[model samples]
Target: MNTFLYDVKTKCPVCGREFTYTKVRMSHLKVLERRKDLYTKYDGIEPFFYDPIVCPNCGYAALSDVFNNISDEGKKEILSKITTNWTKRKFSGKRTPQKALESYLLSLYCSQLKNDKDIIFAKTCLRIAWIYNILNDSSNENRYLKISLDMYKKAYEGFEAYDGEIQLIYMIGELNKILGYRDEALKWFNKVINHPDRKNHSLIVNYAKDEWQSLKI
Candidate 1:
């Protein structure tokens, strides 16, 4: 057993089964690099490998943050669509990159079944892209990045107000730049720089400025 990984007891919202899922210790995380799009490289275990909590019994899986927040109706959907075909499998031990990829894919599927927010799908897709980035699989990485970009755009256009709004705007630009959509990237970066609430988010504003300047060159 890896000392860096610890099990957390979780109750599946869809199937009412209690299970344990793996999580990485925060103390063990060492940031090696952070890309403009916020894909982080870590020195030791990839913490994200343990992010999508899976239920061994019923196949319910989602990012840890939203794992237990499914609605009653969502539970029914998962029961019908996922649990009915779920094979008993455990995801509690330390995970390999491939296993992590599988977990994220499962989370993506469950998110869609539950009609989760666009941001949730975007986040899952972005993580999938990051994993592919680590695997040096540019083709799959770009495919997921494009999906993430589309989802982010839908989320940005749909919501009036939400937490992380500023960051989301900035991510739109960053992802566009990453995907080589220079004109669209520049437009979003400008939106972030000139946003009325920029004063409250100096860090994001500064990042936007830096990316904007880089694009201009």
Candidate 2:
């Protein structure tokens, strides 16, 4: 059986003729429910029916189809994460996804401030960029990463510059990897492991480290 790559739209519903129509891959179709816990359970179309998105042409829809595509476990995981994040943002007063992530990171870094600081904001920015990355929106991805690097610069100010060097290097290495700068990423990873802060929490570059080790470069 072939997988339905796009939304199935029938031309003449009564005749059962396949339609030749342009396809639209809209944003992630989210089904919002009043009961967050119930939705996280991944039971079905929620307590009531809600359309996450609509077709521009024929207006055909099957909300259950979307839910059926992904497994119940996956649905529960995503719904739970959304609920948790939403709860965190409530206290942080960050309604937008962008602000919610930033606020969460800032709260995490609030106590770690030293005469010198860096990496916290960059990590936050990386997380923020993921919101767009998941949606295949390169425009926002690069934009947020650039902003993250700028934040890293600000984070590195007025303190022991070497404290978070490992994490800083890791973040730079990850960025380089994404930007297709393999050599530069390797160099950054090298700098991370050898840096004084290597023992503490770093940007967690295990994949790059493993790959680089295998390459024997």
- Each candidate's number of clashing pairs is 0, 4
RMSD of each: 1.4, 18.6
Task: List ranges where model 2 is wrong by over 4 Å.
Answer: 1-120, 153-163, 197-208, 211-217
lDDT of all predictions: 0.89, 0.42
**TM-score per candidate, chains pooled:** 0.95, 0.39
TM-score of 1: 0.95
Best model number under TM-score: 1
Q: How do the residues 1-217 of candidate 1 rate in per-residue lDDT, one tens digit apiece?
A: 7878887786778888788888788787789987778777778778878889999898889998888888888888888998888889878897888899999999999999889899989989999998998899999999999999999989999972336688899989999999999999999999999999999999889989999999999
Candidate 1 stretches greater than 4 Å from native: 160-162
Q: For model 1, what is the error of residue 197's alpha carbon versus the real structure, in angstroms, after optimal superposition?
A: 1.7
| Pairs of residues at least 3 apart in sequence or in different chains that clash in candidate 1 | none
